[model samples]
Target: MTIAMPVLRPKSPHFSSGPCAKRPGWSPKKLNTSVLGRSHRSKEGKARLKLAIDLTREVLQVPADYLIGIVPASDTGAVEMAMWSMLGERGVDILAWESFGEGWANDALKQLKLDDVRVIDAPYGRLPKLKQVDGVARDVIFTWNGTTSGVRVPNADFIAADRQGVVICDATSAAFAQALDWPKLDVVTYSWQKVLGGEAAHGMLILSPRAVKRLETYKPSWPLPKIFRLTSGGKLIAGIFQGETINTPSMLAVEDYIDALEWAKGIGGLPALMKRADGNLRVLNRWVTATPWVEFLAVDKKTRSNTSVCLTISDQAVVALGAEGQAAFAKAMVARLEKEGVAFDIGHYRDAPPGLRIWCGATVQSRDLKALTPWLDWAFALTRAEFCKVAA
Candidate 1:
């Protein structure tokens, strides 16, 4: 059962969901190096940071009133800061359908120890019941896109438009690639490394007026770390949102992010980014629709992610091997692709079900995905044959 190897390979196979493929024409030389050695607090340095923020607002089309800030640690830090600063203000509703979402749920139930917390969850490949959320009375926390499970909320229709509480969203994998319902979200967080394919460690935290009001009014019962502090003297730290970061930042990373933002702006802003991502997903969807051996991990098409497109083996022969065997087969297929230099980092998230998670973000060219599918079929055919022989 020797499968013929595909002659064509993807032009770029740097699809590791995080620190994803750099923009189509990214280069180190394109970055502004002037900010590299300057102190982030210096006027020149702060201007670079401010430019990144301004471009983000322009690219994302965030409401003029919403505040955008580059926070410490990345998306995780931004989420934690929001959770610690605001969750205890009212009863909370947390939703989980993937690892990152579950992690946030654990923080509320285990670490934060909030008094009135309700956790609504679903297994991988499916979304939680959005109707179960009580956003009107309780603060809501959820991820707009589940990077691991490859599921995403289709829209924010379930969230009340006139709710009393705030909605905190981890949009790390969705920003730029998807249109976020800004009016429904109070606190949205993302990282430079995910959608735009920028350098890591820096986080973009966008806060609505409601979130800022919570920060200025309610102080958390637990002690706050300096990095997590967002307020002073019973007023919002307006400076943080204005590029005056709480701690010194990586000026190099800031410049790289600014480079990415500028690139995004040059390419027709948010609409173009979403179209590119959607086009990539369409390429995968057409392949999946025609390929019986594979199907999306996200059960529902409506909730399927355009960015982190997760897929699971549908071949009954592979499924009969049980969980460990299926995982091994999937890994072998991934390894074969990697070894052939056809694709890299296409394996499932460690915490997710046994499957393949291909990053189809905006930075990934659709032609690469179309070229990669035949290689996937070639790899799977060869891997299945080897696995069957081992089982026999």
Candidate 2:
């Protein structure tokens, strides 16, 4: 017999965006080992690093030629390193559909101090025309997914094969949850804390030969922080990109990340993982379409994110929490779900419209999402009634 989804509870939480919800039969205690205080440069750290990289490769089916490395900082570290270390010499065409991608473009224009920067920006729900942008003259920067706005680029087919500039992607929410056209991306950065449901504080930087070559040939005039510096004497530092860190790493967090990757592999790699995310999203799609009070933040179906499914309630009472009060209500509902062991951390991004942000990542099972929908409905109803009583 088929099963029905229940409203999510925190003890059995249904949604969490990052440093996200864990998989079945996994817990922090399961990550316990005596490596807490050990130097990440030691043999113990090396083993953890190798396992982490190996597992990432296994789950992602990363190319044999491509290198996977533990870089300093989270997704921001890896991306900023690529921007600061690789740009300035070349003209850049940056794509911004949402906040994080826009943040990168801002860095390129204002911080990198680049001579020529072309920016193609769009509203939160819509995507700018990628075709309108000239790809031949300038290098391109874009996000595979817009986590905060819940929009993502549909494909990399638009990126020309022989384009002179490199393609840099911040695929934090897209990786593991979607199929990546790696050949089109010269530099890709993502954090384990997203889809892997792993702990935060670390990010991974994956490079194509083109990106690596750029790093080797170009030298920016700015000072290279140990974390952002990827080379020495104009030669790529082989160690940093090969699971070697320029600074100390948290062995405990490294192991926890490994544990999540292993779980991802156990559930069948990316194909199966994508199916899970798609399935969970279908649940949200149903809820959003049938319920008048809620709808996707993205303008169209093609750009809507399957990973971070952000929404805004349509009803006045539904929105009355004011942006701040609504955000708090969203948090309160998440807490209420948590208190009842129904769901947890379904709050929206701070700057975005009021409503809930549900993580429909692969790590979250369909059964749990099936359970979560009802909880969201239940929580919204109760919260709205209470909110209305106060207004009256």
The most accurate candidate by TM-score is: 1
Worst 10 residues of 2 by lDDT: 1-10
Q: Relative to the true structure, how large is the alpha-carbon lDDT of every model?
A: 0.92, 0.81
Q: Which parts of model 1 are misplaced by more than 4 Å?
A: 390-392
Tell me the TM-score of each prediction against the true structure: 0.98, 0.91
The TM-score between candidate 2 and the true structure equals 0.91
lDDT for 219 in candidate 2 is 85
lDDT of 2 by residue, 1-392 (tens): 22233534334565778877777688888895767887777787777788898888889988877777888789999899888888877788888877887899889877777888889999888888989766666788888998888988889887888877888889999999988997788888899889888878888998888888888887888887877888888898898766678788888888888888888888788998899989888988987888866788887898788899888776777575577777767777677677777767777777667677889898787777776677777766676666656421
- Residue 32 accuracy (lDDT) in model 2: 52
User: How much does candidate 1 score in TM-score?
Assistant: 0.98
